[model samples]
Target: MTDAAARGLWITLEGGDGAGKTTQAGLLESWLRERGREVVRTREPGGTEVGTLIRDIVLHHRGDVAPRAEALLYAADRAHHVATLVRPALARGQVVVQDRYLDSSVAYQGAGRVLDAAEVRELSLWATEGALPDLTVLLDLDPAAARARLDAADKPFDRLEAEREEFHVRVREAFRALADAEPQRFLVLDASRPAADLAAAVRERVTALL
Candidate 1:
């Protein structure tokens, strides 16, 4: 591989719960592996042992967690995840297909929880030493639709997913605003579309990066 190609790429999938991010991420990872590229598929809040513990508290804890405390927990997970997993994979020239990142924190904690969005973002940046994805694919879907998908799946809701519709609405708006502010780095797509279509669009973007 060329020097630039050997440097690796970071791609993050961001969206509300049940937005098909996992489906798309799996497709992207498969496509990249088919092309003989090393791919590290991981997710925030549960990407490592430390993160898994944090994930249980933030996502599965039965009781309420203070907004700031929740955000801090996520940031702590991000710090460990990036330092121990993401950065190392990238340094080895492996594509990191992460399920979520700082953006999710900004949307869920900042917008949904009514915390300061900028502060949440800054906190995440501090946690990760300013690490940012090369490309962020946002699966834009209506809150109601996403909720319906979750309901149809017959799965239990996590703490965040169990929130009210208005909370999810705020999260959707926050994600849109974030994508608008950084158009160059985000590839926003309609998540209501077929999985194949979404995967194709994602692949087109990643193909250019490759």
Candidate 2:
């Protein structure tokens, strides 16, 4: 295939805050590198230097950010990140394993914040020029269990994570709905599974793509 036709694969990890996305991302990156593939590991809202500033305001600000404003901030970060970092790396045929994507916005802002999911997704699509991942691995977990994991980590909660259990429940349901609506694009897995097993499943699907 021509370079344009064989553009680099994009993989995104989606789940609640304590669903082990970071661990899986690290394992996936290591596995891809071991196979001699150039991998670009990144996360939304902080993937670019500009995005870092946005991330701070969105996640760390001690003020109430309107739902629409929060969504716009995330979109702005996405636009810059895709334009400057993600697109260039993909053009060089590098595998991008990202921590989150538009899906997170839909789940967090749309469902968690009680905004319109479709409108949120459309805004993101417009911002990123309709960019979508080749694969989206959804780590399904109970919000309570996820909260327990977060507690065990002993880290302060971010804006989204600091929300109520009901909000997290809504976010989880939104993620499941999105995955259901696009079975071909999503691989839904129980996050309670062993890390090795989860990694293996991810590798299996990625192997097929490679």
Candidate 3:
């Protein structure tokens, strides 16, 4: 098949904080490019101009933004990201490997903030104009391990990541729930595995899907 004949592939990485999504995302990008596929590496919250502003508000918040309000900001950012970046890239038949997307909002703002998943998904549809990933790579990890990685990284965990331990636990559980809800769309792997091996496994999944 011609390069342009392949449908646009939206691959998202979903997990708790510090699940090594970026590292694995980069690996997939390079791997796909080697096969002559056009790659559009992007992320939610900051993929577009307006989205970047919303990202700052969401991540570096000075105080608590109400849960639903925070969710709305994420929705706004995603709206812009999908319109300005994701849709256009997909129209060109590029492989879109994102660091995170709708699932992050559902896990963080939905479960972490104690909102409804059904409501959150509806908001996502409205904001992203109904964009959904073809496949999602879930780096399932224990909350303790994920938290330790964040703490050891020596960087501020930011507003969402700076949530209480219990909150993070909820987020992790929410993500696992999401994977269960969409088995066909998710490649859920344990995070306790070696990074290299995990990366290889993720690569194999994306390779097979493409």
Candidate 4:
């Protein structure tokens, strides 16, 4: 990033599977762009080439991988993404919005996957070189409702989607617990609402940040 390039706001959306983060990330990116904010919307696992490869192994591996392995893989992807895309973009004053992040690893792999949160955070720091989001918008919703929506939408279940109902419930609660612990950094929202309403809520929160 040069002096002339813009600085960036790194905003990440965190939530359980089927929580509509992908849709919301897209909508938020468009809103930021419309307001003349340079934006780069991306996701974990497949942002950069290296990260993409890691994502495939983590997401589509034939056999089950350990929780630590899964957490490290996500951290690897995050490291590449931040070094290649996120950090530079933020340095240039772009709004680097992303779907999923280290929090997912901590909640899903650590708490949900039964890995230690302390270890997960340490690994994430190594992977991302300790880059933290300016704000984390956690789309809070019941795991049952999220699964129901995914089933209703007729989307194929991914590996994470294949977890037990109780697993997802723990993951969602972990996210809520994280937000509670870091109220200043989190904007927890009810993800059960209609899309338009959810989007509106997200925009309002982000607008204040801007």
Task: Score each candidate by Cα lDDT.
Answer: 0.95, 0.94, 0.86, 0.85
Encode model 2's per-residue lDDT on 1-210: one tens digit a residue.
Answer: 123237888899999999999999999999999999999999998999999999999999999999999999999999999989888888888999999999999999999999999999999999999988889999999999999999999989998899999999999999999999999899999999999999999999999888
Q: List the candidate numbers ranked by lDDT, top first.
A: 1, 2, 3, 4
Q: Write the per-residue lDDT of candidate 1 for residues 1-210, one digit (tens) a residue.
A: 123366689999999999999999999999999999999999998999999999999999999999999999999999999999998898898999999999999999999999999999999999999999999999999999999999999989999999999999999999999999999899999999999999999999999988
For candidate 4, the 10 contiguous residues with the lowest summed lDDT are 1-10
Model 1 alpha-carbon miss at residue 113, Å: 0.3
lDDT per residue for candidate 4 within 67-142, as digits (tens), equals: 7778878887888888999988888778888998888988899888888887898898877777788789999888
Residue pairs in collision within model 1: none
User: TM-score for every candidate vs. truth?
Assistant: 0.98, 0.97, 0.94, 0.94
Name the runs in model 4 displaced over 4 angstroms: 1-6
What number of clashing residue pairs does each candidate have, in the order they appear?
A: 0, 0, 0, 5
Over 4 Å off, model 1? 1-6
Which residue pairs clash within candidate 3?
none
RMSD of 4: 2.5
Q: Which stretch of 10 consecutive residues in model 2 shows the poorest summed lDDT?
A: 1-10
